[model samples]
Target chain A: MPSPARSALAHIAFSDLVVLLRGIFERHGTSAEVAAVLATNCASAQRDGAHSHGVFRMPGYVSTLASGWVDGRAVPVVEDVASGYVRVDARNGFAQPALAAARGLLLEKARSAGIAVLAIHNSHHFAALWPDVEPFAEEGLIALSVVNSMTCVVPHGARRPLFGTNPIAFAAPCAASAPIVFDMATSAMAHGDVQIAARAGETLPPGMGVDSQGLATQDPNAILNGGALLPFGGHKGSALSMMVELLAAALTGGNFSFEFDWDQHPGAKTPWTGQLIIVIDPRKSGGESFARRAQTLVAHMHEVGLSRMPGERRYREREHSALHGVAIAEQELAQLRAMTGD
Target chain B: MPSPARSALAHIAFSDLVVLLRGIFERHGTSAEVAAVLATNCASAQRDGAHSHGVFRMPGYVSTLASGWVDGRAVPVVEDVASGYVRVDARNGFAQPALAAARGLLLEKARSAGIAVLAIHNSHHFAALWPDVEPFAEEGLIALSVVNSMTCVVPHGARRPLFGTNPIAFAAPCAASAPIVFDMATSAMAHGDVQIAARAGETLPPGMGVDSQGLATQDPNAILNGGALLPFGGHKGSALSMMVELLAAALTGGNFSFEFDWDQHPGAKTPWTGQLIIVIDPRKSGGESFARRAQTLVAHMHEVGLSRMPGERRYREREHSALHGVAIAEQELAQLRAMTGD
Candidate 1:
């Protein structure tokens, strides 16, 4: 067998990758605007070594678009709801475009009110959630976001799957370093990671999921096929998952994780649900600068013998990508190029 | 060994318990208003069977006050910072009174602006977090809160303790039932629970903590004596704990868990940190009543074989308490009575 690390590799400039992905998205039925937003998001993920949400998701996005399960060209309708709230109807399109359409107004409200919330519904979210919040932190604001996906996780103490692998993402600015950011799935293992492991014919760690018989198993294939994932951290993680359902779906007037049915669209691969983003302007906080205080906390974390911060690896990957280009498998790059009619 | 379950139990009316606790607080140091707020909070915890934060915490409160580590008579100063922000300087007092002082304004802002945040600093929080949020849910709003405690938990991948047993609590209204509520310590175990286990001469589940030598151990006494707890769910829980420190302490301009040193006042059991509460008015949402949507989700959860929901146990205990009075160990009740000079 070929050594995986020594396999043929392709490296592309981040912008070139974004342009290539944009071509693929536009060719796959998305509007140029939607393509631009999604391509950048996907490219950024790839550049930061977030493979599951990078080019790995392109086929899923394409298939869903081809199946007509999502309206790639639908325009988002932004609502200026209140002093501190903005709502968006994604019109059956992807969530990124909805956020892009409402981002300016959301920022304005957050600045003026000290805090603001954006509610996007009737949308499909199939990307990493960190992207939704990180930019706010870059702008010296704190941001938190939650998105509920299709049900594949069992609520704690439940006999079967009833909740999505709901995820939460948070970002905060720091003084002399990258913004602190983390995006975590409430499930013991993210569905995409499980898929990756199954594709690689790898076994999983114990307690990640159960087989169809509801017995514990370490086989990734079992978890992916007729089995279910468990919530991370037991009941606490389950409760956070439930909270995600409430905030993203119930509060945003979108379909619950289990409410959407796509069996009729056989190629559909996206969950039609909702997303919530909250932005807070730290200038309104008391005493010292929030970023400086965050830096101090990070310093203490290092002092306590921590070798890495939660999102530090991503930052390192980002820097490496800046110097050496975004890495990809040569075979996958060829497939992507072919999809764009190269 | 004696059967703990068969221990003699004492029952006291919830209101009576509040009055008793209030007298104790007032007699110790607090003003009537502060006493009223804390007494009710403490009594409610006992009524809901949250023993870790109920009567068991009163001695710590008294000792902290008597040692002059906290100003029980200090008046919290509430500031209307912005359309969606409220700030409270707790004046080195308890967080509950600060929250009480700003809550009315916070609610008005949340209703008017759609969402609002309250930042309380220079405060000590030594109570169950759920009580801080549950009332907001009962008032038809969504609430989430975080508070940082004294350092005792080791961040994931860190060799020593640096983070507190920081906790996050959330509450949301549900139709046809009590609100959904949860209060979770990001730590593998709450410090109070470890203390309780140590007092009972019991061992803890594995992965809960490390001894002073930084080796994993199940002995609760070791965890309480110069040892440290671990974050729940490993890295994910550690990230949440870090986020708690940023939100509750950094953003509020309060001391980080490791920043405060209470050695001068030897009996100081409280962490003089900060707290943050975010409230949202669901009326601003696009949904068919948010509460009704939540109810639909809960129904589906039950259909999927979930036998109980988060916070259901607390509600059940509360119902029992209402019917038969709040249950407490007979010995503990005697101690409480003596403390009140009754």
Candidate 2:
């Protein structure tokens, strides 16, 4: 990608960015609270340098709201299906509020039951999964989450897309320092990352995906046009994707990747997906020393020239972005401004 | 790697194999019931053709017992840490009996609470993880298990072994067929498989592991000599290994991979590690329709030329072995008979 046109670049404080995003969603018809939740999440992504899931996603999201593909005024409902289980119905709306509502409940339930699961359905989760699990880890809980999205990846040995990127996130709190966290898509490359590469007119590295004929290719345009992404680590990654499909979609009564022909749609629609979250109270394991033990393991990673833990790079990026402000292209800012008449 | 000396072969009924294993363990010191639990698990692994974890592991196990590295008479104790949580202290014995004791309780707890976790410590887990989770899925529960072993895998980019193979297993129930399951090691190749390749005078494929100085190598001898196994899928698998270390060792109060160097030890001892089991009831998500939905997903996999689900191959192997009888090399039979004086 060429250098950003600096004359059209704008660096806004994190606080200001949040306000801008919140106002844009509000103008598009979401409740103030709902918009705030979505805005805060997106801004955090920007702060963490996850640009694909940050403000860059605004255009498609606003389009979904304006078209009523996602209900702007929806109030997610939660049902306590069992002592330690929660089922969240997002009511065909954005996933943020629904996930937020279950967050506290999950912590509470995990503490009492030792473990808990929250299943969310009929939601559009156009964000990173780390944000959802990271909070639990910060609160002294071990957390894991998986979400299925529009089909973009092919199962191992398959010629066509039959599974979503299906990212899985996990986090464990540490002593004093930030939590150790990882968020990864089951695909060799994430669908969002692929889209970014395609937009930048970049050719993908070899082996990330294949063309429609099932032949491996390095052309991003060919992939975005009619090709399918391959699973990471070949068969091992394929198995992980299969597990995510079962846990999030089949179990939650949400749309499976095969059920959605995302490419066939005339207009972009909300990603109707399911999410599965698991919360575990570390204290229940009789470990007040879990954090320290985890640090011992992490120290070994650092020694190996790995440089950073899974989410450590993101934390550093977030701090730098917070201090310097997040940069957005002037064109992107203008589009948001136009969408909201700001 | 050479063909087994079939002239020294024995065909044993699965039931007789279990009884013979039980008798040997009982003679060593464990009570009849404890031996039965362990023996049954070992036989089942053989029945499923998981030879590495089956009778092939018996020699080392017997050595551990003979050396008193593991307490053959130890009775595992379980405490209900919370409504849905259980902690099992294996008292320096094998993992099978400890897991068996908690199996029924896990199902009941999950039925009522929708999720349950069982943590076993001070145990030696040598059998495949599928047996632990497969029973839960058979009982109409979704199950996942992770166990950390003696460290043999280097975290991605690291030269030293600081993480175990750290296998994770998952199972989901279907309507009428056997449960769908997968058990995978985070390592690019299992240590046992590497040993087999070395014995066969075969070169390992690239990216499987590194030599002692951290240079990538295709020589299995270099890998098994002083080298460390690489995590599967590079960094993604490294992240998965880290998670297992946290969940099974850190959270369960067991030793981390770096904390133990069993490979360097001169004496054979049980892998004094921990196992974490999680069971979830899909019925809590509101319907008995889960099985049909899972079949729908499996159908998609089948159409893609991925003919079998993760566990289907093993299931078929188990069925064939059950009918044909398990084959044991005559020398292997002699070895077992010598150890047991039978």
Candidate 3:
């Protein structure tokens, strides 16, 4: 049993955590600046209540790097940019740099034209897409970002894993509230969540997963072994996942389902993944005064007693954490300290 | 009870539908030009198997017009355009002409700027987003079109209707197969289908809708009166509905839920009604020749046994209908003839 106040847990300050993460990444061959950026992103995720995407995943990422799956030192290089379109090659680089380069280029294109699409190939996993979309939303733009990972979910009616837990994120700007951002995975549950459930010895949620025999089941172990996560809805979610695969993987020149299998080979040294980021400047796309009207609409929805805007709650959480540092479960804190050899 | 025919029902000449629809619209105060466009759009929807969006919707539309809810004689006019971004004042015109004009202008902008977005305000309902999307798909471009209609569905937990059955359509050019087009409503079932079931005295499918008491129910009558259609998969689907509304309505100067009582005013007369259409040129975006790589990615998915591409089945249906004219249910034919006084 876990205790709320366990002595094994140490409360390392947020800054300390960032420094430790940067140190670890630097030791693993990441450049100093890149390590700092990666550390900041990890910390930000934790602040935003996205603990699943935060530093808790750092150990697995390092293991991937150690296994020679991800190149810690690679950098993103521009492939093309004209009019309102941009193409980027990550050169087997960390996803952060690639995403950064793509966003920068996309902003440039959007500033020049009314809309811009940044297609990126050969990138590694980019953490929670909300961060990538937020900056664009802050600039009064509407943005959609998607990425397709290695296969982990099954199509509707199929037993085998044939698609990634492809996630799509969209952000819209508002004046008073935080930007409305909706980020989601097409699968009923992400593979990482399933692994967590298995480790916890808990039954998976109904309709979330299936067993080796192609029947829906609640056993996480069975799903992790040979079964697959079902899509959110039957065919609609499957169609959405395929759409993401084509847009992110196909359009960006990355491998699709059959070309790369996460099950056959688990860790890194896998083929480079793909991502798509689209930005629409509301000011440019819908006349100069569109953002103001958008703000009014946001206010209207809230006035009607909608609980919260998509990202507003997250933003509120982040604000609270920034004022009073975030709290982690005692067990997770202890694990982090052990991993750091502190 | 309806019977499934071995072969499709007898062909109803498309020209007959076109002429009848045109005559009906003309009698309802639409100009000859706008009526022609509307008829063409309706015919195409039927051809593509989207019978819900085709001539079946004509009766309700006519009633709205007869009640002075829709402005059938108005013409869409340009409100603003800067840096490839455009805003159109539909003047409550028929949706087909207004939306088509926006698409044409956006394509022209894309030709010069590589990407473009067109925001249309005060437009009436547009049927079958596929037809609107396919034109861009045919031009070797990627397109996304979305519309926020009268509030029809509920958000995740809410019993009252708070969101429209917003539909998002994405179209991308493919190599070997037809263009990959996905058009989906955020609700578990489109509201039109509920109406269809109600008219036929059939029970709605489980999870399709909710009764006025906020209980999930299959009774279409309750759903029509005050019940809400649940989002497809609860939170995720609700998030998508919000996404479409923000992008389509907020940015395009449309009314938010609280601003308009759609039940009181079914026709699109409010100045707040709006839509957003985006067109992207793949040739200008992806690296090392996007078209060739798009073909490769699509083939790889097919090779992995996807069974069918996203738009392949729908395109096949359209092809079959073109070879043998579209089928009309006996009751539908009678209703159409009576409405048109033909």
- The model with the greater lDDT, 1 or 2, is 1
* Candidate 3 local lDDT, B13-48, one digit each (tens): 778778878888887778888888888888777767
Q: By summed lDDT, which 10 consecutive residues of candidate 2 chain A come out lowest?
A: A1-10
Worst 10 residues of 1 chain B by lDDT: B1-10
Indicate the residue-level lDDT of A60 in model 3: 73
Residues B1-342, candidate 1: write the lDDT tens digits. 112223599999999999999999998989999999999999998898888888988899888988999999999999999999999999999999999999999999999999999999999999999999999999999999999999999999999999999999999999999999999999998888888788788889999999999999999989888999999999999999999999999999889999998989978999999999999999999659999999999999999899989899889989999999999889888888888876
Candidate 3 CAPRI level: acceptable
Pairs clashing within candidate 3: A69-A268, A69-A269, B254-B272, B255-B272
Rank candidates by TM-score, best first. Answer: 1, 2, 3
For model 3, the DockQ equals 0.48
DockQ order of candidates, best first?
Answer: 1, 2, 3
What is the Cα-based lDDT of residue B105 in candidate 2? Answer: 81
Interface RMSD measured for model 2? 1.5
TM-score attained by model 1: 0.98
Over 4 Å off in model 1, which ranges?
A1-6, B1-6
> CA lDDT, every prediction?
0.93, 0.82, 0.73
| Clash count in backbone of candidate 3 | 4
The segments of candidate 2 whose C-alpha lies over 4 angstroms from its true place after superposition are A1-9, A261-265, B1-9, B261-265
Best by TM-score: 1
Q: In model 1, which residue pairs have backbone atoms overlapping below 3 Å? A: none
Between candidates 1 and 3, the one scoring higher on TM-score is 1
